[model samples]
Each structure stands twice: as structure tokens, then as C-alpha cells.
Target: MTVFGCRSCDATLTVPVSRVALPVHADQKYGNRPGSLAPALEPGTFAVNPLPSGPPWRRWAELEPGEAEALGWYAPRIRISAGPVGQVLLAPGDVRGAVIDPALVSDSACCGIDGGEPNMVCATCGTPVAIRIDDCGLRQAVWLAPLTTHVIGDDLGPHPVLDWADLIDHRPGIPPSEPGGGWHPMWAAAAGAALAHLLATSGGEPIVIPDHQVADVFRPTLDRLAGPGRTGPERTLVLAGPGLPDADGDLALIPQHPQTGELWPVAPPVRPVPLAWDAWRHLAFHRAPKPVGRSVPIPPEAPLALLPGPRFEPDGQIFLSVLARLPEVGQPWLRAIYDRGRPYSYTFHVF
Candidate 1:
């Protein structure tokens, strides 16, 4: 159990938080539809993570090299894939005297709850200490502000990244979709971010993505971005990870250690570029989203257990942090891809 306290007055804002399984979809939106499932984390467990919220960030170009490193290389770029899933979570009841900032409230919020914004405050000192997201048809929980709230308790430390072999065999259940119909938000976000990396891997050349479900989600973006008369360096985005067969021919974007956010280093250190965490996982594991609007009974012997992976966005702050540390950070095309994503928005439209 952990205690989340105000950094200013040391006021105990919350306590006794146990870690829980991170949700499958960090950007999940339980619309007006009824019968949404319960919170992702159980009553006591919670994860601590930094998000794209709080103060507006300065652009990477605006900062000096030393200043950029000091700020953790997290530019103010927005449209992240999902929130960071860390070994941190606190129960709602454990939170005490924490108040919500009215201005942060969203009109689209369910029952006055903001999904993941820093809308929560410490009652004692009135500091924005956390983010409370308990909207209807959505998960209910709190994400403590890393700058304002400190955790006090036993630190269980970081978990190991799921091996590619383990992940290939392990598949999680599908998330409840938005009422109308569409691919999972996490999948879309992953595809969007992956497309960004695919472009980077191509070195501004024309590339091809094979047909199928993954292509279905990603083709539109690629075609739209690289339509007629557009020509340069390009490469194919293929299925190659830790467990799968070795990638042959053209280059591949490999997986990252989910827990440490470390990109899998390709041997010989040439070709096979590194993509963000969730982007690689989406290709390595979540390539096919489960069929929505239906249920099928599984035999008891079937390996239907969901693996432990947090709701993730490849473009999330964590991904950008890792990218900032890489040699390709200076590449003009990569910078353009990152900049192409809208500011402060989660959705990306190629057209």
C-alpha cells in the first residue's frame, strides 16, 4: 500500500493504495451507452504516471540540449496514444480532502467526472495533486500528479517487459466499443503512431504495407499521406518482433520494453528501427482486435487469460520521452511526423 501526499504541506491526500492490473485501453471512452464495466483498477490498487496534462510544454526546438534533457525530453506535442501504465494506483476512498477544480471539468464528462485531466486538488492546501476519472460507462480512479503529489510506502519497483514470444501467445480480451462502431481507440492510436515511425523508417521513401486487418486500419493514413506524385524514401511495416520469425529483406520496427520503455536493440545495430512501446505491441500482439458486439464461449482448456499490459498509446509522453533520447530525434522527417500530430488532441486524421 502507498500513501499519496501533497508536496507542499505534506498533507496525506490518499493512502493504502495497492497496485492493480493496468486497463487494456487508456483512452477508452464509455459513451452514453449503458452497462459499461467497472473501473480498470480494483478498489485498492492504483498506478502512478505522468501524462500530457498540466502546464503547456515548450516545443523541442525551443529548448537547448541541456534544458531538453533536464525536462526529460518530453516536448509539448499532443495527440498521445494513451496514458502511461506504471506500478501505481490508489483507491478512491483512500483519497481524502481532495477537491475537483471546476475549470478543469468537461461538459462531455459523465456525472461531473473528468476522464484523466489534472482536475483534482488537495483540500488542505488547494494544490492540484491528482486526476480523478470516474465518468459513467468508464473506469473510475485517480492518477496522482507527479510534480505535486509524492508517494509514501514500499516501492515494488518496475516489472519486466513481456517477452515477444510470451506476448505473441498472450492476447487480451476486447474492450467495449463506442456505441456507433469503430476500431478500438488504443488500436487506432497505435496505428497512427506506428505510421509515424514507419515513415521515419522509410527515410522519406515510398513503402508498402501488406493488406489485411492491420492494413485496413493503417492503409487509409498511409495512402492519404503519400498519395499521387509523392515520392522519397519508403519501407514496409512488417510483423517482426522478439518471438516471431526473424525479419528478412527490408527493415522492421521492433518492440520496446513496456516497463522500462527501452526499444529492443537489433543485432548489428543496423536496419530494424525501434518504434514506441504500444506501437510495437500492437503489431507484435494486438494486431487483430477481438470481434465486437458478440460473445463466444471458450472451452475451459483454451488459453483465454489476458496478459498484464497497461492501457497504452504509442505517442504518449512515455514514447516521446524515449524518442527524445534516440539518435533519430534530429531527423527532419521524424520531427515532421511528430509535429504532424495535432496539438492537445488524441485523434489523428491523415486527410
Candidate 2:
């Protein structure tokens, strides 16, 4: 079963069975959210057209009589006569036509703890400062888990550049001590390069740079990309190392091309991942033997089990409905499959 919510009235609806058994289709009349299985009312069913400027659910009750009748006729229902695999009954008077309420129903749950302590206080005034500890025990618990262990060799050096290169070469097998490996100068350069690429591809938006001095190196490149005769916005730049300006501090730089005026940071050298024999040799020598997880099964056809019906709104309106049932472990894989199936929406929604 799947649940859908109406943004207007906050009304939620759940399709109780798999949609694959039905001959109905999915509708997108109400934005991109999940649609209902109810049909729209026919022409001349009401005294006035329900096409108002109000929200979608609000227009449901205003449907014409004939249209409303048509909607009522195609409302979804489960027949008891067919045993467990029951028939779909599309009738207006059914209570099952009502959309469910999400607020009243709990969707998911997790375990955690709460705190009531103040961690910081003013040195002179002695004013208590409120503090929030997001994950109290969960983080520490996971860190302490008895997973596969690695013995660190004495050959580990102090250089950041060599360490990072070595780390990348050995990843997907051995876990690095730090998430991004201990800070190194080469790491800083790589970070600068990545930041530059992001800014360039960001479609002319002025982004804050972390390293002002290094950013100064890339300004000309950014200006050329921004085009000529545009006054750029003032953005802050922060350097990563200590003795640098705090987050609140602002450092400004004048634009070189005053006429173009499009201020931008210097472009960092974003070197591509070298596929040379030396790089491959480094991996072959130091790569660790990490155990990989088993692969899950993938269906050749539709990955999700879909349900079908006429769609509807909270105010008793109708549209087409389709459902997608996915496996617990293969969600991403199945989602990729469904995304590829987007062009077939017409065929899937109708039949």
C-alpha cells in the first residue's frame, strides 16, 4: 500500500492493493504528487464550472452535477465477492473514497534521547547559554562498533599531499582514519579546484570562496565566464587554516575588469584523476583487501509493483492513479528503472 497527501487540505489517501491488477492509469493533474483513481465528472453535470483560482482540493465540491456523477461512478472500491483478490468497485458513495489523514497516522519511527544542560556561559556576566546536542549516544555507539580492524603501519608520514593520494588509491577497501584524511596542502589545492569548478558550473551566481588568496588566482577565468559589463555582487571568502578570519569576518577584492565588473574568484587547477600507469601501480601495491557486500536480485521488467485506478482529490474530485511497489534493499536500483520508464507513462496510466 502507498500513501499520498493533499497539499491544500492535508488530506492523505492510501491505495490498499497493488495497482498492477487494475486497468486504470496514473494522472498528474494535481502537480507531481500521487494521483487518485476516481474519474472526472462529465459535461453538464453541474450548474457552474468548478475551474476556480483556488487550490485543487477546494475545487472538488464545485464540480458540475454530471461531472460529479461521472466521478462518483469511477471511485475506487474493493469487492468482497472475489475473496482475497477482490474486484475493484468504482462507486461514489463508498467511504473508502475518503482521503486518509497523515497527521493522525505515524509514518516512521526511530530511537534517541533528550538533554537539558547548558554548555556555555558568559565569562564576566555569567549568563547561561542554551546548547543543543543532536546525536548524544548514537554517534559514539556506532564509532565503538566491533567492525573489521586495520593495523596502522609505522611508515605513515606527516605530508598531506602524499597521504591524500595514497588514501584515494586505497579507498573502497581500507577505511581512512579521517573522513577526508588529515588536512594537507595538496588537499587544500584539490578543495580549491573543486570549489572553482562548482562556481563555474553554477550559472553565474556569486558564491562564497573559502580561500581568498588562492581565489585571487582564479578571478580572470570567472570574469571571462560571466561575460562583460556586469557589476558583480560582494561575497565573502574564508581561508581554511588557523589565524584566518572567522565566519563573521568579510574580506573584499576589487574587480580587475571595471567595465565588465563581474567580480569572481580565481580558478583553481582541477587536475583530472590520472589514469597513468604510475597511478594504477600505486593502487596495485597498497590496496587493502576489504570484503564487499553481496549483490541483490534485479527484475528485468518493471522493478516496482504498480497499482491502477481513477485518481481523485480530497474535495471529492477524480483523476487517474498508479502505484509503485518496491523492494526494501533495491530502492535506488528500482528508482533508476522507473525513471527510464517515464516515457511510457501514457500507456501505463491508461491501461
Candidate 3:
């Protein structure tokens, strides 16, 4: 009686049957509400056919001659996206920055958008706005007007799209070394660490100052610490203030390279004072000594390799790269890259 066999062969197989049949209506099958179909479609059909009429004609005669000419030469189109918000626009590669149009701000709460923190309102409108990453993978700068217009609750508004051209000429809050170029990864990282350290140690408030000015005060101090024959680590300098712990007293000044993770001892001549944004500036820029000799006699036709970029560290001490260009002899220039929320840059030179 107990013989092993296939379920079908033993006549023991059972199959469940459904009572519901597939829907025939397009809306029913597609589970779409009425009027949800695209304008190009017909009822009960999934196929899309071209209209008998060609492309819609615009009356060219209505446009001014100058406007028509301008249209013909308009820049190439670029796609920009911020989560659900996106648009395509023609822009020149040289554009400096984008201006967020005020119209895009939504008055009502946009559901499904998540602001990073609770209680944070949208920067554009007063409602709680969600975090939306911009379409361009590159970080962008924010314009105050559009941000304030569409802020929801306390959430910051989206950064504006930048015109690459304009940024090349403008000065950023932290100017990079080259025009339209970013800093070396090591230096950038170091600067970021320095900033983070300032924030963590300073009760969340970090002071920002000009990069060159910070270097002027710190460079001499660093050089003395390295001693003779010891080249300084490639470093990036950042300024933060207000709440940073006392460098000499409450805090310890431990300098390290961002990339190589090399530890450099804090040298004298560069004393760590309390975090004071204005004081740093005054010491770096206002009090910097002028070179005594005639242009430090740059040897004619001598080729010298520039110093590598600064390195960043997770702990926030930027290891500045000491290049062949010496500030003591020649008028060496220093700059910082300003990333305004997004990766935007402008250069400032220190003579």
C-alpha cells in the first residue's frame, strides 16, 4: 500500500483555482486612474503612433530678429536634477554660476522628501522641505535669493547651478590654487579634517578665514619646526574660529599629513594661539614682513618643479606641501578653494 510514486501519477495532486479573470479595460489592467494616460495614447492600446501632422509649428515671425539670432546660437543643453526636481537648459561651459529661478519653490509640503534632521524646515519655503541631491554629480554653489525663496521650515534650499566660466574669474571663500581647478586631493582632505577638528572641538562653530592669510601666520612657524634640511609636509591650511579649544593650553597642536598619514611635530616660531579669526588675519596679512632683497634673485632660465598639493587628515591638521617656491626669497602665491556647499572654486593670491 505504501508505494512511492509521482504526485500526479498517484492522483494526489491538487491545484488551486482563481475566480478572478484578467481585466479588459486599459485603466483596469494598467491600474491607472482616468485621464492618467499620456496625451499621445488612445484608449485600450499600448502602441504609440506618430500624428499625421508634423512637428508643431511656432510662428517665427513673432520673434524679434535679435532674439531669433540669439536662439540660433544658444548654448548646448545640460540636464540638471535634484531628486524629483529636474530640468534641461542650454548653458555655456564658461558659465560662472546658476541662478535658481524663484518660481520652482513649492508652497505646499512636498511629501517623500526627507530633510536630514527633524525640525529642519525648507530653506526656500517655510515648510519642512526634503533633502534633494542635485542632478549634476558635482557639488554646486547656492545663491541666497532662490534658497530663501523656497525654504521649507528650516531646511536649506538647493544650491544653484554654476556657470563654469564665471567661477574661473571670481574669488571663492577658500580659493583654490588654480583657476577653474580643484586642490590636490591630499590638501583638500587635510583642510576638511582641520575644519572638522575645529567644529568638534569648538562646540560646532568653526571660523573661516582667507587661506593665504592663514598660511602667512602659520608658514613661518611651521618652517622653524621642520628645522634645517627637513622639508615640511605638504599641507592645506583652513581657518575656523569662535569656539575652537585653546591650541597652546586646552588643546594640543599635532600636525600630520592627510595622505601619507605622517606625523609632524608642531615647531616653534609658529605658536598656537587661541582660535581668533581676525587675529590670525592680522598676523598673516597685515603684519607679514616684506622681503628685503631685490626679488631674491631668481636664477635666469632655471627650471624648478612646484611643490605638491597639501594633504588632509581625518583629524584636521592640514600638511602643507613646501614647494621649491620659497616665500622668504620670492613673492610666493597661495590660494584656497571655496566650496560653497557644492564644489565651486575661486582663487585668491597672497603676495
Candidate 4:
């Protein structure tokens, strides 16, 4: 198990935990309302890396031309992000000697505590240690202050992600809305990232996700982004991932290895169109039950609601990151989407 401590004083700060791949919520906006359920982290696991948009970032405009080129970017229009120093994530229970200063809490979010900032200070040396996020409708976690805490314990080298065969029956599920009553960010993030890949690999053709759920989730944003007129072949987006059906279709949203971000290869081999592990699994399990189940497991208080309630906007950065990696960014259709600046402004309901 890995342990983190104070970098300045070497005082232990985090409980011993195993290293885990970065979570989808690592950069997620938590708490749409005061009483939402804050998602919990897996016990004894930690993500010691900063998520995109996490602290310790410099804007592209802040760098000189040589510095920007040194950072491996030919363009400065996009946000240049790097891992923050001393950042760590773990379950709230794993935190030690950290106290929530009530005064540090935000006035805007009062339903549950919104510790979005570094609200927890180390009781030992008075250093800002972490952020305790346990607000309703969001994931509960302790976001360690970068440059304050230090990690102690054996460093595990990068672990290979679970292969496709192992996840065939391990698909995950996501809620349409947050607990406190707001749209879930995962849908939009997923759709945006998926749209990026779809356009990048579309071969100049219009794409379609036959699955009503997926189409409903993505089509609005994609159509708006793809623009009104484009003459080309039609591509199909199908749920194709590990242990699932063959991706004989034009385009497949394959699952990336949860740990490694490695995409499950299509039979004949194709450019990777991987989704973040969680999102991929959500799509993979959208309709079919896990192969091992006779019926999907229902949460104790599952909401009996109609499908496709409302689509919320995705995290803009995540969407951009997904799209920016593709060469298709220069394409007229893709350029239009990029130009929208705030793609989330478009309102579409999933339910």
C-alpha cells in the first residue's frame, strides 16, 4: 500500500492505499444540490495524479513561444495542463489529522458540504492538506493539496489494465441525473469525447449510433457540431467493446483498459476509438445485462423513471481534450464544433 505524508515535515497524511487508475470523477464537478449523494472512492486505493484542469496548470498564453514549443505544442490556443505536484486522492476515511474549517466552506453550496477547494488543513503543522468533498449529488473524496503532502511507501510501477476478456461481463452503470437533481456530467463528457473520435475517424462521412440510447445521448451535440450540410458516406456508431459483440460496424466505441487506457482491438484491427473505461462500460451495458446476470441488479432505492430524461452539458475541457488529439480538428465540421467555445450551452434532455 502507498502512503502520503507532508512534503515539508514528512508527517504522514494519508492512510496506506493501493494505486488505482485515475477515476472519471477525478475532475468531475460535484454537487448540483445540497443533498446529493457524494460518490465514494474504492477503499484503500488512491490516484496520486492530477486530473485535467486540476491545479498546477499554466494557461497557454502564459508561456513564451520557446517554452510552448518545449512543452510539445505547436499551437497555444488550447489549454496546456500538467500533473500537479504532491496531489493525491483517497477515500475520506483514509485522511488523517485533517480538519474541515467551516469558514473555508463555500457559501454557494450549502446542501451538503462543498469542499471543492482546499478546505482541510493538516492539524499537525497547519499546512493546507486536502479538500474533503462529501457533498450531495457528487463523489465523496479527499483531494490532497499539491505541494503540501508527500507520498510514502513502495511505488508500484504502472500496472497493466485489465484485458477485454475480463470486462466482458463487468460493464458498469451510470445514473441519468445527480442525486440532488441535475444532469449527470458523464453523459455529455462521454458524448463529446465520442464525438471527437467519431469525427476524427469518420473518414468524412456522417456517423450514426443505431442504439436509441446512445443516439439520444449523442446525436444532438453531434448534429449541431457536425453542422447543417455535409455530403459524405454514413458511418455507424455501435457499442463494441471487450467480451461484447464484434465491431463489424463502421465505427465502434471500444473500451479502453481501465488502468492503462489501452483500447480493445477490433478483429481486423482499426484505429483506436476508446472511451474512458467507465463511459465505455456504461455504453456497453446500456441495453444488455451483464452476461452473468439474469436481471440487472437494482439499487435499493432505484428511481422508477422513464428513459432519456434530459441531457446535461459535458465538461468542456474533457470534450476538448478528446477532440484536440485528432487531426480532424482542422476539418470544417470539427472546426465548427470547436468554435462553439461553450458546447454545453446547447440544451438537450436525455430522458
What TM-score do all the candidates reach, one by one? Answer: 0.58, 0.17, 0.18, 0.71
What is candidate 3's lDDT per residue for 1-351, written digit by digit as tens? 111111212221111111111111101111112322111111111111111111122244454444423433111111111212111111112112122233443333232211111222233233322122122111111111112122112221122222322222231222223343533222233333343233233221222223454453334433332223533342233332222322332323333221122333333433222221212222222322344686676454432222224431111112111111112112111112111111111231211
- List per-prediction Cα lDDT, in the order shown: 0.53, 0.24, 0.24, 0.62
Error of 4 at 209 (Å): 2.6
Per TM-score, what order, best first?
4, 1, 3, 2
* Cα lDDT of model 1 by residue, 1-351, tens digit: 466688888888865655433433443443355544355544555654443344444554555556654544443443222323332445566678788888776676646476445788888888887777776655456677777777665565333335655544553324323344533444434444455556555666666655243454455556665554557554565666666666653666676444344556555423665544454554455433345675785444433322223322233332333444444646775565455544335664323
For all predictions, the C-alpha RMSD in Å is: 8.6, 27.3, 26.4, 6.9
Off by over 4 Å in 1: 1-3, 8-53, 56-111, 115-128, 134-141, 157-181, 210-213, 229-234, 268-349
Q: Cα lDDT for residue 237, model 1? A: 57
Please state the error at residue 330 of candidate 1 in Å. Answer: 7.7
In model 4, which range of ten residues has the least summed lDDT?
A: 342-351
Model 4, 1-351: lDDT tens per residue? 577877667778867776765654555543355554434456767776633334456677677657645544333354565545446777888887778887787775555666545787777787777787766655677888776777666665333334566655554656556576766666555555666677778766777766766666667766666655767867777778755767777777776665554567776544456676666666566553334654877653443332345544555555665565455676775666665664233432211
Q: In terms of lDDT, which candidate is strongest?
A: 4
Global Cα lDDT for candidate 4? 0.62
State in Å the error of residue 191, model 1.
1.3
Question: What lDDT, from 0 to 1, does candidate 3 have?
Answer: 0.24
